[model samples]
Target: MRIRSLTARVLILATLWSALALVTIAVAISALYRQGVERGFNNLLRAQLYNVVNSVSIGDSDSLTGSPALGDLRFSQPATGWYWLVEPLGNYATAPLASASLGVANLAVPDVEATPFDQNYERYYEMTDDVANHIRVAETEVVLDDQGRAARFRVSGNLQVVEDEIAFFTSRLYAALAVVGIGGLIVNGLAILYGLKPLDRARRALERIRRGEAERIEGDFPSEVQPLANEINALIDSNRRIVERARMQVGNLAHSLKTPIAVLLNEARTLEKNQAEVIATQAEAMQAQVSSYLNRARIAAQRDSVLARTEAQPVMERLARVMRKLNADILFELDVAPDLTFAMEQQDVEEVVGNLLENASRFARTKVVTKAVMTARDDEPTDGRRGWIEVVVEDDGPGLAPDQIGEALKRGRRLDESKPGTGLGLSIVKEISGEYQGSFGLSRAGIGGLRAQLILPAVTKDTA
Candidate 1:
């Protein structure tokens, strides 16, 4: 899976680059080490070649002779890939001298065209011997006597030994570099996480603001992130100003229309009887539309406010008491926790619950049950509120069918013409709930009555 976190991305990239760098270093170091080992091996062979040359001389019969002691045990062992030779040049008829390890097999001289001698008159090359042993040869020409008779002196050593040594060194180098690379990646990860801690803090602060626990992001941030926090706070402030401006405009529009509507109603009373009823009916409808839209505008403005919070217990209890007094024939039951709060203004809460309770009381025969509780939501909220407050009001009266439930929520839709209502109660509750990003639903209650459920964002307790 692809990494989504910034820290993981940084750590992964660092690990990949570190591994690449370490591998390159290991390869370069191995090559250099191989060259150093070969250079030292050649030096050892050249030293033995000079020793063989100095040990041999012209005897009484003008033949080369001497027992060269190089002080290496392999030189005395036959076909051990360690040997020395001295042979006359230019057909001088001098017998060749060889180490015991040669065992009658001669070390072939490299072609001058392929392996040219250096300025020092010495040539070094590698070849496989008769026994298939890889060997390195260092050969030089030296004039043994004043007669100008030159002899070629050659020394051979096992090239396989040098190769094995390089292999061992390279292996250890890779192991060491691997360890260093791992350590470097670990340190890089820790540093990245620590450096990004300020971002995490900013995220949590923004969450608190969204949850209504805070009005703005709070805490010190790094210079790199402080500008972002400032911008966010500015945006929130701008949003509030816009909502407030809209609310004021809505209120002004409502106030501006109310006087005209009232004047129209009073004027209708002065008209003829049939004309007066028509004007009054139309005027009342206009009034209901104006109130419905104004309430919607008010809810829309307050829904986005970060500072809106209301305790459910007090609102439910207060409404229940009022409901009991108003409907003395009905028994009102309230079930709510004192700590259960909503991230909504108290007026909005009262408006929504008041509508639900009033509707239930109007329809209930003898009993109405009201309940409020905090509930864990199934889906994550985009605004960072963790849970919801579910308010349910049920009445033991005639309930609508499943098809009628949807119709009852329509604006100005009254299921019963006999009931005294404008039919905006349930529809306004739905609109208010919707503006707050909550939900409203109607279902059959256990009491065989209409059950209205209102779910709104809840304020989580601050644990910090």
Candidate 2:
């Protein structure tokens, strides 16, 4: 899966680049170490060659003579791959002096045409000896007499020893670099997390604004993020102003339209019965339509405001008391926690719960029950806010059948024509619930009566 977090992305990229750089450094260091070892090995062979040259002199027959001590035990052992030789060059006809290690074997010498000597009259090369051992040879020519007679001094040492040493060093180097690379990656990850802490804080602040816990994003953010916070706060203020303007316009429109409808209804009262009845019906329909649309516009504006909240217990109790007084024959029972709160405006909450209670009172024969409780919903996003409040109003009157329940929620379809209502109460409750992203439904109550269930966004007690 792709990493979506900024911290993880930065940490992953840093780890990859650090590992690559460390591997490259390890390789470069290994190469330099190997070069140094080989240079020292060659120097050792050259030093041995010099020792043999110093030990030789032109003897009585004016020819080269003398054996190299070398002081190494391998030189004294036969075919140990460490040896020295002193031989006259270019027809000198002198017997060559060799270390015991050369026993019955001669060191291979490269032809001068193929491998020429340097300005110091010295040359070095690597080859496998007769014993199948890899060896390095350093060769030099020195004049032993005034007659210009020159002899070649050659020294050989095992090449496998230098290679084994370099291999051991490279392995240790890799282990050390691996440890350092892992440590560096851990430090880089921690630094990235610490640096991004401000963004996390900003995220929490925005969540508070979304949940209606705060009116604005508030925190001390880093300079890089402070401007973003300021912009968001400005937008929220602008949105609140827009919602207020929309509410004012809705109120103005309702006032302007209601007066005309009322005037038309009153004017129709003096007409003939047939015309008066037609005019009154049409005017009432127009009034209902205007009220529904205006309510919808007001809800649409207030639903998105970040500062809307209401205490559920107080609103429910107040409405229940009012319903009990209005319907003296019905008993009202309220079940709600004092701390229960909702993320809705007080007016909208009053409108919704008041409608449910009034409808229940009208139909209930003996008792009406109202309840408010906090509940979790699976379909809602799991942000840091508290879950939701469920308000249930049930009445003990003869309820509608399953088929008639759906029709009762229609805008103008009151099932009982004798009941005095515009048939918009339940529909308004549903619309307001929908505007707040809540839910409304009807089901059979345990009290053998109609049950109205309303769910809306809730706030935690601390924030409420």
Task: Name the top lDDT candidate.
Answer: 1
Candidate 1 minimal-lDDT segment of 10 residues: 377-386
lDDT of 1 at 22: 94
What are the runs in model 2 whose C-alpha is more than 4 Å off? Answer: 61-64, 67-80, 100-104, 110-121, 130-132, 146-149, 255-288, 336-341, 372-389, 458-464
344-372 per-residue lDDT for model 2 (tens digits): 88988998999999999989999999988
TM-score of 2: 0.84
Model 2 lDDT vs. the true structure? 0.86
**Candidate 1 lDDT, 228-318, residue by residue in tens:** 9999999889878877897789889989999999999999999999999889878887898887788778777767666667878877899
lDDT of 1 at 295: 73
Listed in order, each prediction's TM-score against the native is 0.86, 0.84
lDDT of each: 0.87, 0.86
In angstroms, give how far residue 270 of model 1 lies from its true place: 8.1
Highest TM-score among the candidates is held by which one?
A: 1
Q: Which RMSD does model 1 reach against the true structure?
A: 3.6
Q: Give the TM-score of candidate 1.
A: 0.86
Q: Write down the lDDT that model 1 would get.
A: 0.87
